[model samples]
Target: MAPRLLLVEDDLHSRTAITLFLGDAGYAVDPCPDFASALRHLQNAQNDVPDYAAVLTDYNLGHRDLTGLSVCQAMRRTSNRKAPIIASSSEMKYWEEVADVFKLNLVPKLRHQWDGPAILAKLEEIGIKP
Candidate 1:
C-alpha cells in the first residue's frame, strides 16, 4: 500500500495542489482544511500506531488562536509520535523560533511557487520514502 500522509492546510488551493502532488508521487494523502478536522483524524486512530507515515501542516491556518504548531504538538501526544511532522509556512521567523524546540522540519512555502521539490527532499532527508 502507498504510505499515508496527513496534510493540514487551510488554503483550498494549497491543499488541493499538495494533495495532488503527493498523490502523484505515490502517497495516499488525507487532506484537512483546518485544525479541527486534522485533530479528529489524529484522535480517531484505531491502534497505537499512526495512520499516516508523515504529516505536513501549514503554520498559518487562517486562525489567530491556533496554527500548525498546535497540530504538531497534538500529534506529538498521540500514537503518531514516531511519524515525521513537517511544518510549512511563509512565516519563517515564527517557525524558526519553535521548530527546533518542537523537533519539526520547516519547509518554507514560497509565495506563488509550488514547493514540491523541497517538501519531497525533506521527506527523504527524514527517511520517509516516497
Candidate 2:
C-alpha cells in the first residue's frame, strides 16, 4: 500500500503546493488546516483512508491557531507514541521551541524558497523510500 500522510498547514498556497507535489511523489496526502480538524481525522480514520505513515505540519498554522506542538500532543494522546511528526518554520526561534518537546523532525523554513525539498529529504531520512 502507498504510505499515508497527514499534512497540517494553515496557508492555502503552501498546503496545496505540498499536497500536489507529495501526491506526485506517490504519497497519499490528507491535508488539514488546523489542529482540531486534523485530530478529528486522525481519531476517526475511515476504511478509505489508509493508516498514516507520518505527519507533516507547519510550526504555526495561523494566528492563535493549530500549532505543531498541539498536533504532536493530540497524536500522542489519540494514538501510540510511535508517530513521527515533522514540522518546519521560517523563524528559528519558533521551531526551537518545540524541538525538544516531542518526537518531531523540525526542518528550517526558508523565506525565498519553498519547504518541499526539505520535507522530502526528511521523509527520505526516515526510510519512507518514496
Candidate 3:
C-alpha cells in the first residue's frame, strides 16, 4: 500500500502542485490549507493510531498566529509522534530554531529553486520511499 502523508499548505497553487506531485509519486496525501485543519487531522489520527507516515507543512500559513511550527508540535503529540515532519519555507533560516526545537527536518524553499525535488529528497531521507 502507498504510504499516507499529511500536507499542510495555505497557498492554493503550491498546495495543489505539491499534492499532485506527491500523489503522482504514489503517496496518499491528506492535504490541509491551514493549521486548524491540519490540527484537526492530527488530533483525529491520535485517536485512531495515526495512519500517516510523514507530514509536510509550509511555515507560513496565512496571517494566523499559528504556523507550521504549531502543526509540527501537534504532530509530535500524536500517536505517530515519531513520524517524520518536514517543514518548508522561503525564510527557512528564520525558522531554524523552531525546527530544531520540534525536531523537524527543514527543507529550505529558496527563491527560484524547485521545491518538489527538495521535498521528495527529504521524504526519501526520512525513509518514505514515495
Which candidate order results from sorting by lDDT in descending order? Answer: 1, 3, 2
- Local distance difference test, per candidate? 0.84, 0.77, 0.82
Superposition error at 127 for model 2 (Å): 1.1
Write the candidate numbers in order of decreasing TM-score: 1, 3, 2
The clash count of every prediction, one per candidate, is: 0, 0, 0
Reference-based TM-score, model 3: 0.90
List the candidate 1 regions with Cα displacement exceeding 4 Å.
46-50, 112-114
Check candidate 3 and list the clashing pairs: none
How far is each candidate from the true structure, as Cα RMSD in Å?
Answer: 1.7, 2.2, 1.9
Q: Model 2, range 1-130, lDDT digits (tens) per residue? A: 6788898888888888889989998888889988887888888663344558888878777757557778888888765246688877776577677678785787877772237878888999998845
Q: Candidate 1, TM-score vs. the true structure?
A: 0.92
By TM-score, who's the top model here? 1
lDDT of 1: 0.84
lDDT of 1 by residue, 1-130 (tens): 8888899999999999989998898888999989999888888763553478888998888898889888988888887777788888887777788977788888888893338989888888988876
List candidate 3 segments past 4 Å from native: 110-114
| Cα shift from native, residue 17, model 2 (Å) | 0.2
